[model samples]
Target chain A: MTALPASTPRKMGLVIDLDTCVGCHACVTACKGWNTENYGAPLSDTDAYGADPVGTFLNRVHSYEVTPAEGTPFTVHFPKSCLHCEDAPCVTVCPTGASYKRAEDGIVLVNEDHCIGCGLCAWACPYGARELDAVAGVMKKCTLCVDRIYNETLPEVDRLPACVRTCPAGARHFGDLADPGSAVSRLVAERGGMDLMPEQGTRPVNKYLPPRPRDALTATPAATPADPSTEGLGGFLGWIDRTLARF
Target chain B: MHPAPSIILFTTISGLGLGLLAFLGIGMIEPTGLAAFLWFTLGYGLTLVGLASSAFHLGHPERALRAFTQWRTSWLSREAVLAAVAMLVLAPHAIGLIFFNRPLTGFGIIGGLLALQTVLATSMIYGQLRTVPRWNHWTTPTLFLISAITGGALLSGLPFLSQMLLAWLAVAMVLHWILGDSRFAASGSTLGSATGLGARGAVRQLEPPHTGTNYLLREMAYVVARRHVVPLRLIALLAACVLPSVLLWIAPFSLPAIAAAILLHILGMLTARWLFFAQAEHVVGLYYGVR
Candidate 1:
């Protein structure tokens, strides 16, 4: 079961734009909120109210400062979750048949009941996609809001992953990346979306839209120094009077 | 990359147990009466105990049997299956040695090979992980197998074989630290590459997403200071490898000398194995800015 399918019917994934992300933890919270309730078991925290607190979360927004060669360095917010890789090491490295990718939708998930909590999947993950529920001692990750997306009772617009729905900046996009004409696919092509570590060879399904390029660095403009004879307020007043007298 | 105590003990104890089994299978040390009873009890007893210790590492000890299901892909599963097979096959071999006066050549051949194979499979569990570039090396397995063999040789009380294996152990450890350990800094991965920002000159974590230590940081972002690596390497080499060889040279004269050598080597390997897990740089550490 750990051997990946030859191909999935659809490569369902998220595409994120780095340019507009505000580093708000909205998506992170939304993901935690939804998955904690809807998933088979709650993503638990060990010491929630104590001085040292740890909770399992499916997604996180990392803030990175990128210093370019020429321009002033800028900070970029990166919201990271499971990429649902085509060749997910997590799926292959699991001792139990607990962790798996759906052949129908290409969404990777963990069957908690079968998980022995060996944590090998965590070791295999390059992106840190999986987190252990300290309370349940089982692996948990982003299910791409599988429950809501497929729920017929929910409104179509509201049925996306919790992270995608709750993003105030609309930086997150969801669609079938395998489909050339899907909005997410078009976004990937137009913006030159990239894989986080293409060399790691997870062949991640999620694509990241690179930050839009800006004009090369230009020197900061300096204010022209005042002439010695006409620098003060009286000089300006005299110039103003001369103009009035001429009128 | 954090070396959990349970795992450290499991690998160390289990390696020692399996190595003893390997030596016994090869008919290197011929024991009689009480010594034979001691050897078998120690061999199978330590093996089982070490394996039992690993169950403590699981979140649900009751669900540990489910780990046996996946051998096609997982190295962990393969390790379990191979370990089980080695134990099962060796159990009867132990019975034959204890009950019958004659050795079963067939059981010895198969059991010895399987015992060594189990240790090799255990090494592969960490070696195959691409996430930790420090561990994904040939030296990792070589170091593990050599350490096991050296331990086995020493405990089996073969003074000559112990000396030779001690030398081999030193070579493996040196090659492992020199080639394998050094490759981490030289690896092409950078914070930029980790975050898809390689086009930028430099990238650093200004602020972590969460204030508290998450599972990723707790589990993978373990950091060892650069200054400590050398001294520890020396301790591991001198105490674990060379000291054993020198002690084994005098072991023929004094039993205490051989015992000292085994103790020193085990201590040394414990240090080295601790370093093995502690220093492993998981690519996920880049997310936490520990790499």
Candidate 2:
């Protein structure tokens, strides 16, 4: 089962825009809230109300400061999760047949019941997408919100992934990446979406839209004050114009 | 890599065990009756104990048996199956020698070859990992094979073979270190490449993903200072090969010298194995700004 299917019916994935993300962590919190309750295996925290708290969550946002050669430094909030790769190394490396990609949707997932938690899947994943649940003794990762997305009982509008639904900036989009007609696909085409590390060769299903060009107009320089008291005839005219503008 | 004590113990001890067994299979070790029994017993002991310790390293030890189910795909599964086959063959071969006074026969030779194959499979488990560039090399299996054979040769007290294999082991060990150092220096990953920020020229992490240490940091973000490696490598070389070979040379005259050589070699191998795991930079560390 760890050997991937030759073809999947649909590659369900996410496309996130870096330009719009404000890094509020709403999506991170929403993902935690939804997955902990929905999945059969709760992503447990080792110490919920202790001095040093640590828990297993599928998605984590990494903040990085990038300084372009000619421009000012800017921070990019990189939210990483299981990319549901076309060729997921995690699935191939699983010895117990626990880690697998769904043939129908291409959503890489782990069957907790069968996982030995050897941590092989984690090592295989360069993205650090998978983590071993120390409490449950199994590997865990982003399940693509499989429980919620396919649930017919939920309202149609609310049937998307918890992260996508809660993204206040509308930065996150979820749909079938295999279909070029999907909204996520169109968004990818328009924004020139990219993969995290194409060199690693995971062939990720998810795409990321790069940050927009930073304009000096928005990041304005400090203003030098003009002393109107010591200049020529134009100074009194400028002062009059400035005084008129203030009025 | 985390440099888990159990794994270090497993590879080192098992390497020695299978090395000795390989000598037995080739009809190189000369022993009669109970001595032969004891020799086989000791070899199997190291292999099994080392294997058992590795199994214990698993998060769920009870599910360790399920690892054999995916031999066709997983390297771990291949190791399990090959090791099991070696054990099965070795049992009867050991029985024949101990009870029936039979010298090394067809089955015994097969058992020895299987033992060597099992060690190769074990080495392949790490060597096949594309994530850890340091481990993904030809030197890995070469080092494993040479160490096993040399250790076995020493145990057999075969003076000429021991001398030759010890020399080969030394050469292989040095090659592994030199190649490994270069591999570390020339790591294919960079902070820019890992983050898809190569075009930006320079990237820095003002804030990490988490405030506290997480599983990735604990498991993959291990770093060893450069200052410690050179001295340690020299120590490993002296203990594992140089002194062991010199002691093994003296072993032809002194009956107990072989034991001393084996002991010193094991210590050296332990140090070397620790470096192996500690030095392995998993490419995932790129995400944490570690090169």
lDDT score for residue B31 of model 1: 67
Please provide TM-scores, in order, for all candidate models, with all chains considered together. Answer: 0.94, 0.92
lDDT of 2 by residue, B1-291 (tens): 888899999999888888888778767774657998899888888889988988866878888888888877787777788878887876766777788777647767898898889889888878877778778789999999888888888777776788788788889888887887777546456777667766765887767777766777778878855459888888888998888789867656577787787788889989889888888888877777774
What digit string (tens of lDDT, one per residue) describes model 1 on residues B84-194? 988777766667777775566677768877888888988999999888888889998988898888888888888888888888888988887778766666666677877
Question: In candidate 2 chain B, what residue range of length 10 has the lowest lDDT sum?
Answer: B184-193
Query: Model 2: how far is A25 from its true place, Å?
Result: 1.9
Q: Tell me the lDDT of model 1 at A159.
A: 86
After TM-score superposition, what is the CA distance of residue B54 in candidate 1 from its true location, in Å?
1.5
Error of 1 at A219 (Å): 7.1
DockQ for every model, please.
0.75, 0.58
Badly placed stretches (over 4 Å) of model 1 are A215-220, A223-247, B224-226
Residue B96 CA displacement from its true place in model 2, Å: 1.4
Clash list (residue pairs), candidate 1: none
Clashes, model 1: 0
Give the distance in Å from residue A127's predicted Cα in candidate 2 to where it truly belongs. Answer: 1.0
